[model samples]
Target chain A: MAVRAVVRRSFYQDSMVLMSVAARLRGQPGVREAAALMGTPANHALLAAAGLASPEVKGAAPGDLVLVVDAESEAAAAAALEAAGAMLEERSRASGVLRRPRTLEAALAARPDANLAVISVPGAYAALEARTALRGGLHVFLFSDNVSLADEVELKRLAAARGLLCMGPDCGTAYLGGIGLGFANVVPRGRIGCVAASGTGLQAVVSQLAALGEGISHGIGVGGRDLSAEVGGTMTTLALAALARDPRTEAIVVISKPPSAAALPALESAIRATGKPVVVCCLGAASSGAPGTWVSTLDDAADAAAALLRGVSWSPRAFSDPDSVRARLAALGPARGTIRGLYTGGTLAHEARLLLEPLLGATGHRILDLGADEFTVGRPHPMLDPDARAAQVREAARDRDVGVVLLDVVLGRGTHPNPAGVVARAVRDARETAARAGRGLLAVASVVGTDADPQGRRHQVEELRAAGVEVLPSNAQAARFVALALRPELALALLGPR
Target chain B: MTLDAGLDQPLRVVNVGLELFAEQIEAQGAAVDRVDWRPPAGGPDIASLLARLED
Candidate 1:
């Protein structure tokens, strides 16, 4: 009687016996448990026939256990099994011919002219992929976010060494060599080049420039957190130097939402040394005695950049006259109480404080950075996170020291779906709480984005205004108005030209 | 039955098991040959042999 023999081998030891038979027996259907133990040719031939084993599997010896399985039949089952194994091997080899190649080797073989690799992998895997692409001698357009600062620095260093471009780890937007990569605005190519810290702000400036028939040589987005206290403005410095050197860029625009004082001096020095005409728009604040050009609002920044590109010097203009706001506040009534500013953007809150501190004598009013933990408690990006605003409205409304409450609502894609609802609810709650406390609440608010419906952000602005919150067009203007309400004296200071 | 015919030309054994068997045969200085076997092509009975191998 014919009998079936089944063999099993573990990878721990007896490695040699497994090699010979592994290839042939690996994918064959007839083979059950095939392993080599000690030195045995029994499984080696089986593996070789199945093509399951690697080239290294051929040298397996006896006294090492290799596994093999054979189905017994009245006829020669081994030959039939071997034929089946060969057919399977033929199919596998043919399958490769039938399928399109997806490996790097295949891509290079197909398109030898492909010089750039645009990577949009997950953040954690970005560095690895970037390193691989660099090793492969391809320019990288990295579009991943949440990459650590150290990784970015190291990657930038590697890219510089390789003489290749490393766009971003969290770089949401960029226009590279006239190609729009990632989430970039379609702006014409012109003599002006821009490097912005904020993504949406960059979009706004680029769109506005395009509208004015001005173009950009390049608009590099140095991830939002680059200019913050922690990162120390590393990418900004690099971008400034690059834009400065580019011959196509007759004028350069460096935009950020204000950097820490320590970061400013270094950046200022770099800009002054660039010798190229520079328009610096630190969104919510004026440059602190820096010599380069300055603009306060995003719209004005775009205007300045367009004018500079067209060989014209555009002076900074106020979005809304601070005096008008002060006059309006005075007309409302006599000095009521302390002013309160609850702002989404940290830079906006800082700007409001700068405007109010001198006028309110620093102690008369409060400026809260809703994005700050001390104010919002465990909330991130205050405009997107509703819980923070919910708590803030109640606190501001209940405080007897607070009479005027100023809010800055930032609206954009990747933000809350209904920012209007958020603002409306917060306003209603605060108003009710203040009314119950028998205090009059003067609520002034501002919308950050445009009417282009950037994720229906315009609706939020309309809702806030409809709900009786005095809405301004820009954060800078809103913060200025908030400051004037806090201190009538600062209004006069702003009215005087510097 | 001609059982002994072509038996001396080195038995062409195929180990269609898992990675362990592949590793073992690879170490023995013999090349492994792998083939893809599916149901529609009518291959040998693997489950019964596997059960026997376990036993």
Candidate 2:
């Protein structure tokens, strides 16, 4: 007679409750199994009880009470059960039980102010979750990466019909309402808002802005691969439009790591139409000019953003000026036949290609996208994926054509076993191999993340630089430096005539 | 029963029942806060009560 009345809700409605219950039941002694069902559908209850057929007992409705009991002492158990039941009844009467929200109708009835729905289910189930969220009149933040482009397009279209913001299918970082969502920095609230096509790049700017004592109204990360030739800038366009109308935002900072040329014009035009001041930071771009300000480095982007936030007017500095760059390049000694561009992020490779492509021309084929499918293979992140690319760097050092090998080392939370160790070993091995080949190999690299990262970016960059690889603040800067070393003439044009 | 003198320390009590608990505890010269509670399948247990009490 010791009755246990378990209240169940839909996974969509009461996930925390369901998960907590499952966890508790796993530890409980008397409870052999526990299942949370959406409804008292014969199939659902049967599935919950390990597919055992339920007896012809009364079935419970949505918020109805059902008691199940198994106790040795019937009288005591019944009395205890009744007491528990009475307590539950009293609690229910005092504060009504929330019915399991089945349809979009039910979900909306519960959380009317819920503007955004974040779907984090498996890839196959993501589309349904998104559809449900959209139908519930919620803006969908699709956290599920690797969703097909077709599915994304449909979801985006649906979101537009309801006049809602559909953030991303693989959107990693966002700062909404002065709160960090996903991998984001906690900058204070200010007039400057961002809609970036990169996560770490966006984070760098946000952190730097915070350091400068400037706040951010919002930092919307529009995924790294958004501006590629294939995807175009669907979300970027919508985000720009929304931020333009946002009263909190007085200025906008658009950041990207050198998107394809085809994608640039449309994005540029959108910014121009916004009328609000914009600070553009397309990493690896030699020069950029809009109706607003242009910045080169990630640090410069943050500085520009902070200045904008403070309503302080500022102009862009020419970091990639040719003559200045050539002077610096010429000042350095003879060609260290081998140089390593060690980078943490993937875009560093694309940035390196831009800088080196002009100098090395076609021979820049040595540029390896470490995070690319070919290199990383089954691994998660290129920098986090150990030994495979590290070994490649070792081999590259032995190649006679390989004069300078660039390494991009990105530091952030959740990056595998300290990146310093990986780069340190790679640099050590590469330098050793280059020396044996009777060629000097200079390891020129950059640390992508900031002090906000627990791995200690400053220390890691120092470690790599101390190990003989030149460490720059960003992957793009490192690539620029490598390009300067390779073709001093191009460097002269970029920095100004020496 | 007499109140535990140790309860003189700053304490936070979370009640799952309703605001009535808050009123009752306050009547007893103790502080209790009411919060939304959606207990799992097995319903409210000792651990949950402890968690609520801690909250």
Candidate 3:
């Protein structure tokens, strides 16, 4: 195999665009691995670590954009590079507009009444832009990543002092006044407001709420690291204050894993101060009650919020229907004991781990978050790329001790247009790979979306089911089903019928 | 003083970074303008800039 690199000077594209372009290159025959990134220092490091950096890439200026391809042969490498160039050119022409402004000052000058600034630059520059935006009297929706913790702290502090919202440095999703941003779903305007530290977690809950004929007034994304000890949930506290005072939001939902000890007290207090009913889904946090409702999962968080607004009682949904669990276990016969979970959503994966560890033992289950840094250093998120998880599916199928391969398919705006279809092909192939070896691999999966999402939940589930995957109702249910496949006795005892 | 004070108002935005963000805002039927923003000279050093802007 050979490697090739293409460098374009003085060009730029956001991370997701480059990731999508690279995904296209990987789909080409003979392409082994591909990455399309700007020539920033961190991106340079990512390329070097991935073994895709060449002399040209090593010498590239931060203004340059780079595309690297590792292919089966010189001709294939050349073809992939040519295809990548065409993709970039097509993208540029597609956005063909007149001369655009190049600074925040110019933008505000053009539109003096502008109150919000959505920042989506490289991480090295994100904090700087956010600072400028905040100084210019704009609330910031920071959509970049790789920002230092110190930068996040300073930016959030500055925004708070100015009485403005600074949504994210890695904030993936938010909805304001019915406007969706960065992988958000389509939900109607209603009374419940949401503040979340996890992107897909927000999507899962809001989509569920929409499914239950409920809607959200606002959805604030505090970047994934907001609740860390250093950040101390500064933005979360501020967001809670903002949502609490918003008259349109009669109920509120806060979704995240249990926050740092230093941040939780203040966070809980802020929630209580809202004076409105609150639904807290701090997964892994001990269940709590009173002025607020505590939910163990994202689905229950939505239910709690809906119940608060509708004046109904709330209860957590069972992981799965008992009859279905028994039927699945009976179908598995005498299978291998290990379960492999490949997840694109980190919190969902963490939740599955929390559910499975006590039953299967931590080492017994392999629940991999493909969106984690180790897995996504230079690649697109599994939600967008699907290649990494697909490869893992094959790996799981090949493992002699693995009988069940679990998955979570998240669909919405800014995600792959057809994530289930992309994954379905791999699911079928992995089952075939296992069957050829005279072994059985049960693919258990769940869809985190609603019928209202761009990729309809019904269709995505149908596609996965057609590929022979057991499509369960939720991620927790999927994990429980995998547990049942591994150890029926333990699964029956722990996850009895609801 | 409260975000509620502004919740009933029509959305107006100054998207200083990505065009997709502005596009999404417009798609939502709100008014938005894009700012082709880049890192300031001296590369994201906002201490002095923030001091000057706030003052």
Candidate 4:
């Protein structure tokens, strides 16, 4: 194979944009591999490890953008690099002639009254930017990931010392004063507020709230590590206190993947101190919830929050229409192989694993988080590029032991405009591929969205249904439906006449 | 810090890095200004930025 590398000095782009561009280059004809990353030590090390480090890379300054391509021929490699260059040029052209401030200080000078700084730089510099913002008397919404635990702790402490909030180093969802950030849904303003450690977890609950005719006051994301032992629930506690003090937030909801042993007590204490009715969804964990109601699923969290706001009692339901679900599964006949779950949302995938393990055990069920680093290291998030999950669906179809395929389609701003429509094509292709081998594939999915979402919930759901997928109302229900489809007799016995 | 009592002052946002976040805010009918931010070295050099910050 031939390898080519080019370094463009002082050329800057956000990490996500470079990652997506590199992924696109890899898909070109005759390309073996492609990478577009900043010339940081870590990224340079990555290039060396990939065996594509050339003399150009060695000579590159730390501030340069290194583009490398490994292809079957020298001509192919050069052509792909040119194509990548064209893509970057096109982006520059599309941005128009408006000048943008290069430094935070300059930006602040331009907008001195700005209250929050949304930081999405690379993980290495994320904490530095966050620290600058906090010191400048601005709350920070950090959207970068891969930051060190020590930096996260220090940043949160600094924010707390200044009586400000440090939302995340990997946060992807939040809403403040009717403004949505990261991957968020458009919902009406209401009395219920949320503080979550999960991005899609926050989106799922808020979408459910909007569906139930309740809305959100503010949805704060404290990043995934906020509840970890190292971070000690620093931001979670702070966010809870902030929400509790907000006069418009009549009720508060907190979501996470169950806090660490050391952090749980403090979180529970913070909840009790709030003096507001709190609903907590710790994903799959079984906790006493102490001062607040502990729900099992993201959907349940929203239900509880809505009920609290409306001053009504609410309970979790297995499925919206059990009879219909059972009838549909009963017709699908006996499933012969294992259930394979392809998910775009990491938390949703974890929730599926939690729900499926007791019934199918560790060996019988397999769930893949398509959004994980392993799957998205040099590619766009699965929510933006469906190619990764689509490829996985085809792989599952070829596996004779795979009987049921489950998926989660998350919709909102900053996500694919036609997620359901895109996944529908994959579902159709996979089923057709499986049928050609005389094997049956039962596809199940849950679309996390609302009617108010730009993707149009009804339209997305109808698209999935039309593609032969059994569309459930929520991720948990979709998991349950998959369980019933794969082992109808056992699942029915467990439910006991439903 | 005291939480704002309600939806205060039409929600002016300062997006430090990602334009997408600001776009989402704008789509929600809020005022948003993105910083088109770069690293400390005015490039993709996180290593240099981190080294300087450590100083």
Candidate 5:
């Protein structure tokens, strides 16, 4: 086998495009491993970790484009490299057919009255583009991650000062006027609005609300760190104010990874100032001493918000069908062991961890957000493609200590069309793997989407259930089910708060 | 309407990166302008420097 590296000076393609090129080459005959990347230090390290970095590759500059190919023969490596060059050229030609604007400025100039700019550039350039959009008086939905906290604070403050919304530096989901944006679910338009610091958290809430015969006014994501002490809930507060003014919005839901104690008062103040009933679903947030109706699970967030809209008293919900879920787990007859959670949404993973750890203790469970940076260094997020999570499912099943595997299949635009299928096959493989080892594995999961979603919610659930996976009604229910299964003595008490 | 575009006015989107996202927006029947984003020829380090200058 031969491993070779080639560098092209001053050639930069979109990182997503390069990653796709890498993925395509990996599928080619005789190719064992490949990566197409700009020679950033991080990329260099990633390539090196993959054993694709030759000594010549070690000296590459950030300005250079690098392709490292590992193949069955020297000739194969050269051929693959040539193929990579050809693909780039073809993509470049296809890009010209549209004659798209090369800069945000150029696009905005053409649509001077454009109100929103969805900035999804690489993190290094995202802030600059976002700044330009905000300066041009557009509400910014910034999708790029790795933006510094200082930049986030500045941009959000600037947006707030101008009476505009700056959604995220790492925000992945939002909906405006029934229009889904950046990994959003297609839910109907209604009076419930959302301000979330977690992407799947918002999806779970809105989709649940939709399923409950409620719809959304808007769902805004304020990046993950907005509620950190440093950023101090800048965009969260602004989004609340906007929702408050929004005529269609009767209530709001605020979701986040529990805000820092230092940031809570600011968040609470914003919730109060809205002067509207709000569903406060800060997953894993400490005891509710704040204003507005607070709920623990994303499921209850929807139930409470819809109830508020209906003029009915809101109550916390346990599981949709506790008896059936319990029976399913009992039938699995697994040993009481640790939980292994493989998740696509960071928020959903955080929710699952919080729900289980308090009872089971944190040490017994291993929860992972597959879309997290560690899993996506040189690959697509599991949301865009399900292979990473699928591979992890098989690996996690091999552990005798893992009793329950918690999974979430979040369906939306721009995500894999058949995430549920990939997960089903993975779970089936996991079950077979565990059975061969004379161990048992129980997989519990939830679908976070409405029936209108392209990958229909019911269809996804049926797929998992067909594979012997007990798919629950909501994320919180799935997490709680695992807890109940592990500690059957806890019983219905596990269904409710301890 | 001026402060919150989605309140009544149609959402006018300028998708600034990732061509696929633009296509999805368009597929949803929303009016969107695609920004064919390319990094600075010098790559991310140069992009960072350019960002600082833009700031």
Candidate 6:
């Protein structure tokens, strides 16, 4: 094996372009790992930690662009580097005739009427740009990560004071009015607005809302830590205020991985002030004690929000249909082994773990949030590259202890074009492998998308079902389905046939 | 005074980094100005730069 590095001197490019170029290189023959990153100190540290930092990569200037490939041979390394160069050129060239400015000040100068600044720079510099935009009277959509909590607090404070929205530092999705920002899905425009601390959680809820014939008016991403003890739900509070004032939103959904104990009061108070029907899906927390209807899963949050909008009485159920659960278990022969959840959405993965642990107690299950930093080191998120997680589904077939394979397909703008097809092919391959071993591999999945999504939610669901994968109605249902399959005794008790 | 006031107006954006974001907004008929952002000229004294920007 060999390592090679190329530093494009002082040539900066967007992280998405770099990630795509790197993804292309990873697909190249004999390439072990590929990273295309700007030459910043933080990136340098990441390369060093990953053992990919050559002296050249380490010595790169912050303004430089670094492309590194770890490959099978010297020839392979060099070839991948050349490929990276070409991919970067092709992608960066896609920038159209829009005037490009070097500084935010210059950008605002040209378009003084610009009310928003979408910042996706490296984390070391994300706060700086976000602050600049806020000071210049632009609501910020910060799509960068690795920003310090201190910086996030300061930036949110400034935005709050100026009555502006600062969407994220690690925030990945938001839809303001009809415009999709960051990695958002093509959801239907309707009356429900969302303020999310989890991007994919927001996606799951909004997509499910659309599935329920209720759509979002606006989806505000408050990064993943807006409700942390340190941040004190500053942005979430601000977003709540904004959503309250918006006439288009008749109801609201707020999603997070449960707020910090200290942050919950203020957050709940903000929700109360919205004077709107709110459904809170703060995963892992039983009840936020807020005025809004508190739910455990993103699916329930959407359901509750839809019901609120309809002025009908509603509460979450174990399964939307209980008869189907019993039928699914009976067909699978109540196979009981280790449950493996291979997921692309981090929040979805978290939900799976939350659902499975109570059921699989004493016994075991493995849930991999493949979108975590460990899995997505130099590569794009598994959302953008479905083949990675899809390929993992096949690995389950080889392991006899693997009882059921759980998966999630997230359909959105910044995601893979045909994630369902990719997973469907892998499910077939895994099933074949399992069949060869005279074993049954129960593949369960949830598609987080709406009919209006670019990938066509209904079509994606059909694709998964066609491959013999039990396409559960929601991520919560899919995870719970694995639990019921592994312990069929639990199914009769948890979800009785109607 | 809040985001609602701006939501009614056609979204005008100054997008820094990722031309694709600008393109996505444009595809939805919103106006976006792209910034070919680089680290500020003297490389980056990140902490100091953040302090200056905040001020």
- Model 1 lDDT per residue over A424-450, tens place: 787788888888888778888766544
What's model 3's lDDT at A327? 71
Q: CA shift at A294, candidate 2, in angstroms?
A: 5.2
In the range B1-55, model 2's lDDT, one tens digit per residue, is 0011110122222222223323433443433333233223332244235434753
- Cα RMSD of predicted structure 5: 2.7
Best by DockQ: 6
Candidate 6 stretches with Cα past 4 Å from truth are A1-6, A19-59, A66-99, A396-400, A433-438, B1-6, B40-54
DockQ of each: 0.01, 0.02, 0.45, 0.47, 0.59, 0.61
DockQ of 1: 0.01
Off by over 4 Å in 3: A1-6, A20-35, A41-55, A68-87, A287-291, A491-498, B1-4, B14-22, B35-55
Q: Can you tell me the DockQ of model 6?
A: 0.61
Give all candidates' CA lDDT scores. 0.57, 0.56, 0.79, 0.82, 0.83, 0.83
Which candidate, 2 or 6, would have the higher TM-score against the true structure? 6
Per-residue error (Å), model 1, residue A435: 1.1
For model 2 chain A, give the 10-residue run with minimal summed lDDT: A8-17
Q: Tens digits of per-residue lDDT for model 4 on A290-348?
A: 77988998878988888877778898877777778778877877777888899999899
* Model 3 chain A worst lDDT window (10 residues): A373-382
Pairs with steric clashes in candidate 6: none
Candidate 2's residue-wise lDDT over A291-322, tens digit each?
Answer: 55777667678777777666787664435344
lDDT comparing candidate 3 with the true structure? 0.79
lDDT by residue for model 5 (A1-498), tens: 989888887665665787778887787779988878878778888887787778788877765789888899998888888888888879878778348777788888899988889887767778888888998998888888877888899999888888788989888998877788888888888999999998889988888888898888888889999999999998888888889989999999999888898889988898989999988888876546799888888888889988888899866757687667667757766447788999999989988888787778877689989877666654566788788789989998888898788999999887789899999999999999999998888888999987788898899999999998888888888888787777776675854432
* Weakest ten-residue segment in model 5 chain B by summed lDDT: B1-10
Estimate, for each residue in A106-155, the C-alpha lDDT of model 3 and write its tens digit.
Answer: 87777777777777676667787788788877778887777889989999
Candidate 6 lDDT, tens digit per residue, A200-290?
9988887787778877888999999899999999999988888898889899899998899899899878988999888888889877346
